[model samples]
Target: MPICTATLALGSVSGSLLFSNTDIASSNLHSSSVSSLLSPVSNFSKHSQRYCCSSRRTPWVCSANKVTSNTEINGQTSPVLQDSSVPPTEAVRQARRSADWEAARSYRDSGFICEGRIEGFNGGGLLVRFHSLVGFLPFPQLSPSHFCKEPTKSLQEIAKGLTGSLISVKVIQAHEESRKLIFSEKEAEWSKFSGKIKVGDILEARVGSVEDYGAFVHLRFPDGLYHLTGLVHVSEVSWDLVQDVRDVLTEGDEVKVKIISIHREKSRITLSIRQLEEDPLLETLEKVIPQDGSVGSDSESISDASNIEPLPGLETILEELLQEDGIIDVRICRQGFEKRVVSQDLQLWLSNAPPINQNFTLLARAGRQVQEIQLTTSLDQEGIKKALQRVLERVP
Candidate 1:
């Protein structure tokens, strides 16, 4: 047989096959002869296929492996064998740390420390001063347990008292461009008071501010923070007319109050100074004296008698006229007639009284008088007299 040469293109190798007539006739002599030659060559190609290896990207491969098998490539399996031992990239690790640091810095920069002092105000809000800059303490933020309900006058008084007091406060915020520091005495007090206070507790406080309608009292037990300041309304402070809050209370006036409400999370306190005093209605009722004088006597008359009873004689007839309509203790006077009636129906009765004759005049105790009523001569005097008598008979 002639010599036959087969050049295989395995990996980068490229060639062709050359076979003589004698070699073909020999390979075709039997099926097993053809298989033996082809099987050995196919097995060698599978084992000798070379794979390029790379460590920089994913799916690292080894060049020693002639048989190619696919592994991770572009995050998926490739048609070549690869190394599975490569570690994560350094850039990814650095990016994660950078993200963590940025998150921390953002959290740090979101908070700040501010400083301010209590300034004068009247009812609207507390004025705070910081290095010639001004801020506001809304009524809601003025105290830990007490909120000023009607703050108009109270703020004014508080502003007056805070004028010279050196106060320390927390920075709620800072207006950098304005150079304004928003401070909160309430917030500082809340840090200490949130744990101690509850609703319905009575507290002793000082009057830090007063207004036409109310007063702000600094609580003693809760510390000297303005957040613990209790409010005493003008109506709550006294039963008398409160033309001005300054009349009854001044700054630094120590007083007692009650805690009406508390908002812990919001750090709000609602206090009442009036709760320390007796209710005005109850007090006045307790002091009221029982009636003791005769119903028709001078002592029984109102202190002002311009509307009191007329002469006793006229009172008898007036009582008769009033009795017809369930009126009692009827009193006739020059200025006006007065009586206590069960119903308003007595007005009609007064409009129908018999006209007076001869302009007669009469006097009664408490310096009241009964003037004459104009009448017609033809009117029946005896019938009118009988009508009066009949009306009196129906009264108890």
Candidate 2:
């Protein structure tokens, strides 16, 4: 029997010793013989093999065992090394740490979600263990629920409460050489909810915050989880124009909203409160205006118009139209609004005064730029006059 030599090398990482065995077999060594003699490490492609280790309980057993032997020119047999009783040294541990960071980067760039156990806490965030590598999840990146609720509790106490919990996270930043591994639990939370959402889905939501342009709604799904968030533009608050979102929705207000758009990659959800409500103009047209093109007497129509509230800027524009053109014919058109037939000059004003669209716009009023005004109502001559007065009184 031809004998092969096996060499056991010892290395240290942070005072811990590791053993690696290199085995060189004879040129004619059988493949089965090698498998029977050496246990297999993790099977990774050449590039990945350095960073990923075997699933074995011991860390010392490595990919080196999988190396195939090369034949010598003189037909000399090489020694087969089976490492045994080697403890992981400081250097080996550092290398593993480097490997862990590399693994984190791979997961992040590939948009892979990882599940990890919360090990402990640091000043910046909680320490999360992804397999053998430990990653950092900053407190800000944590789910909103993780913040310390008790005023008396310190941040360390809050972190301690989360220790030992299993959490799902996405790699946000990963630097192997610099030993930086950052994860985001909040992103992971949204990712889990993203799959269940669709456009036109109605959901119960609470106003999280109100901005000038729109309001952020914390959506409650069918599962009763309030993890998803959506935005409701001011235009979507009501059928009538909205000058302030605060007037329509206060913080914590419960509202039914329809999902209008969804941008999953951007983690954005657009919602509409008006979609869940009947358009006031449509309602009035159905009840007040008969199918025979009759709206009762002119006085009755005036009374109906008086009951309807026009949008802020609409009254001013309509009052100007009414003053110039007497006895205006106000009729609801098929486009969900009454057609206003003003003089050609007034038509230019309608086109240039302000645009009525989904977004807000700044308008020059009294030689100063004023906040956006949305006109979203169908109204009679009387209603227009009243709304105009209100708009004029508020303008600077």
TM-score of each: 0.32, 0.52
lDDT of 1 at 110: 43
Best by TM-score: 2
- What are the per-residue Cα lDDT tens digits for candidate 1 across 33-57? 3332221101111111111110112
Q: Least lDDT summed over 10 consecutive residues: which range in candidate 2?
A: 342-351
Task: Give the residue spans of candidate 2 off by over 4 A.
Answer: 1-88, 120-125, 131-134, 144-160, 289-292, 296-299, 302-396
TM-score, structure 1 vs. true: 0.32
* Clash count (model 2, backbone only): 25
- Clashes per candidate (backbone, < 3 Å): 29, 25
lDDT of 2: 0.52
User: What overall lDDT goes with each candidate model?
Assistant: 0.41, 0.52
lDDT of 1: 0.41
| Candidate 1 Cα misplacement greater than 4 A, ranges | 1-171, 174-185, 222-227, 263-268, 284-396
